[model samples]
Target: MKKFIIAIDGYASTGKSSLAKQLSLHLNYVYVNSGSMYRAITFFALKNGLTPLNKENIDRLINLLPEIRLDYRTNNVTGISEIHLNNKNIEGEIKTLEVSEYVSLVAEISEIRKFVVKIQKSFKNKNGLVMDGRDIGSVVFPNADLKLFLKASEQVRAKRRYDELINEGYTVEYKDILENIINRDSKDTKRKDSPLIIAKDAVVIDNSELSINDQLDIIIRLINSEL
Candidate 1:
């Protein structure tokens, strides 16, 4: 069997992570959530009072980047992977509305993007892997065997995000999530460093009306053809 590097890129809350996880599991490949890496950094900055609103503070956060260690550990019971920051499991903390509010700001920094890209690239050398993020296909792994760019309407994406957050016990407003999604879309696409652009050879998937099984079936059929 030929292993593949699967890169899934899209705007925030487009179900990129969910799709990548399922694809990886179905193929017994490694699933990597690239956005969680940035969120973890954003979470660390906020906890340490290094808000991206202050240019100097953002620089300080970059300076302290050497001390930041990001990794993943799979849970034995559920066989699901969790993001780890400096050996602490923070999968739960990084998904909050607070992290979403500032993650784009943190990710807009060139140094931060570069740092995360380096880690993202390292996963490719290990085994068959599926990575999902804003820039995974366009920047992190341009030569990936399979590249998928997922997209959805802002309203739909926001609603999906709102429901997920609420289910996770976060008190969030739909309007706020919509605004954040819009802001992130602008920042992610307009940022100078590794802006979220679809690769020339990537397949675009508008999954706004598609169910999880429908989406996965589409991707699996594509993968089978490739194999």
Candidate 2:
């Protein structure tokens, strides 16, 4: 069996990560949540007091990039891969609303994108891989075998994110999540480097009204066709 790469790109809270993870498990591919890489860097910056990453401190952050070590380790119990920063499991830490607030800003930096993209591109060496991010298809892996661009209405995406945070024991307002989604969309699409856009040959999935299983079935069919 020949293995191929799947690149999933989309706006924040559009379920790109969820779908990509599912596909990875189903296909027995290495799953990479590219957004988590950005979040880890953002969390690091926040911990080190290097943000509101201005012109003055941006260079400092860039210099510190070599010190950042990111990798994924699968949990034996849940069988899910969790991201680690500096060999420490920071998956739980990076998922906070605080990290969410700054991730897009950190990702907008060209140097940050280049650093992460270098790591992202290396994953393709493994052959069978599923990676999801704002620019995975458009920038990181333009020749990916299958590229999916996900989209949903702002209200729907916000509600999904709010439910996720609430279930995680975080007290968050839906309005705030909605605003963040809107703001992230703007920043992601307007960024001077690697702005989020659908690859010309990519398939777009508007999952506003679809269930996870529905999405899985649809994507599985697409994968079969590709195979």
Q: Which one is best on TM-score?
A: 1
Q: What is the C-alpha local distance difference test score of each model? A: 0.91, 0.90
CA shift of 199, model 2, Å: 0.6
lDDT of 2 by residue, 74-134 (tens): 8888566889999999988887888988898999888889999999888888859999998
Cα RMSD (Å) per model?
0.9, 1.0
State, as a TM-score between 0 and 1, how close model 2 is to the true structure. Answer: 0.97
Write out the backbone clash pairs for model 1. none
Model 1, which residues run further than 4 Å from truth?
A: none
Runs of candidate 2 exceeding 4 Å displacement: none
Candidate 1, TM-score vs. the true structure? 0.98
Clashes of each: 0, 0
Weakest 10 consecutive residues of candidate 2 by summed lDDT:
73-82
